[model samples]
Target: MVEIISIYNYVMRRILLIQGLIGLSLYDEIGQGYLNEIDLECYITDIIPTLAQVSNHLHPSFERFYVCTVVKKVFFFLDHLHTRRIRIKDIVSSGLLSQLLELRDSAKSRDLVVNETGNWFSMPAVLEVYENYLDLDRDHDGMLSKKELSQYGSGSLSPIFLDRAFEVCRTYNGEMDYKTFLDFYFAMEYRKTLSAMHYIFRILDINQQGYLTAQTLRYFFDGIEEGIKAVKTVK
Candidate 1:
């Protein structure tokens, strides 16, 4: 089942590479336009100088932002390859992998120099949370319940939303694993673009009934209202 889902995702991503993600309709034209207009090699050359300039000047947050921007932009180039049905893992295995690996290490070293902060990187933070999950998995079921995941509301998310979200968004056995947790996190927290809101719906749609009941929406909005009030009242 897991392998089937993984392959489905892989194929969908590849199809999306060529067809554009229907969920993110705006990006469809943008991606197409990018393919038509951008000379990727030239863009890479332009960014080389910009990256060198970014390193010479730094504030911690700004440095992180700049580095992340560069990383995101570079990763965007992967879409071109994706459009060609090339898997990034294969690319990672190629001669380019060492360079890409070093590139990230250099970025990480620079980021560390800027901020000696703990667990600033995403993967490490996720791993850290994974350890926390293991500790909190009281039943040893390898699944986290609402009681266990309540702590997810510590910052950015509302406890109410988390509670209701579990009821709505559960993909399997009315429970959540690390992967599903990440999906919920990204969908609600980052909420990066308009289309990402589908994730929210997945969380809000109770009963797999294909539409949200007013009661469900009201349940979610109650969380939003509570979240707003809490934020406003925070000391």
Candidate 2:
């Protein structure tokens, strides 16, 4: 027997979700029916005590890192304008807030608690990303230089590719900050997704003329060619 849910039920469920999120927005303080970074951070922090029930491995000191990472991820996907605030409508439509709230009673399974289908609120996922950044940072600095990032993903990425990344990505003193690194990490990890593909496309479209040219392809490919020669020499 198929348990079919009617359209009316689906609409009612959506309405309830929006209502709940609007109530959560009371934390906005400015009367803006949106959650700013601080608001989101505070909300997540409040839930951490309950979330700990399912996340036994979470250390006390890691709370700050967890909150910051989750908030950044939410905004990265939902804050389309990079405004640092997510409107209730956007939050409801994305269903991200509901997924986040579910952490309060999520199952205790390691795999479920960790990745949870790439959930932003997953403790293990956030920790893994932070740990990866720490490993690559090498200097103990809170930023990654092009040389450090070169050590990423088999360490075979081309110099011209790195140049284009640095040219396009947000950096300070020629280094990538954690927030910026998150963007780079996702673009690489989910390269097949439209958003990630668009990001990579921007990097490839070096001229920023809104399109990719064969000359640009050759320019980056030259670096890959050189890399192959170097590997052959090593062998």
- Which 10-residue window of candidate 2 scores lowest in summed lDDT? 108-117
Cα TM-score per model: 0.39, 0.78
Q: Report the Cα lDDT for candidate 2.
A: 0.77
Candidate 1 residue lDDT tens string, 135-191: 766788978777677655455566766766776654467778754554454444446
Over 4 Å off, model 2: 1-20, 27-39, 53-57, 80-85, 106-118
Compose the digit string of candidate 2's lDDT tens values, residues 147-196.
Answer: 99999887889988998899988999999998788878877876776657
User: What local lDDT does model 2 show for residue 16?
Assistant: 65
Q: Largest TM-score belongs to which candidate? A: 2
* Each prediction's number of clashing residue pairs: 0, 0
TM-score of 2: 0.78
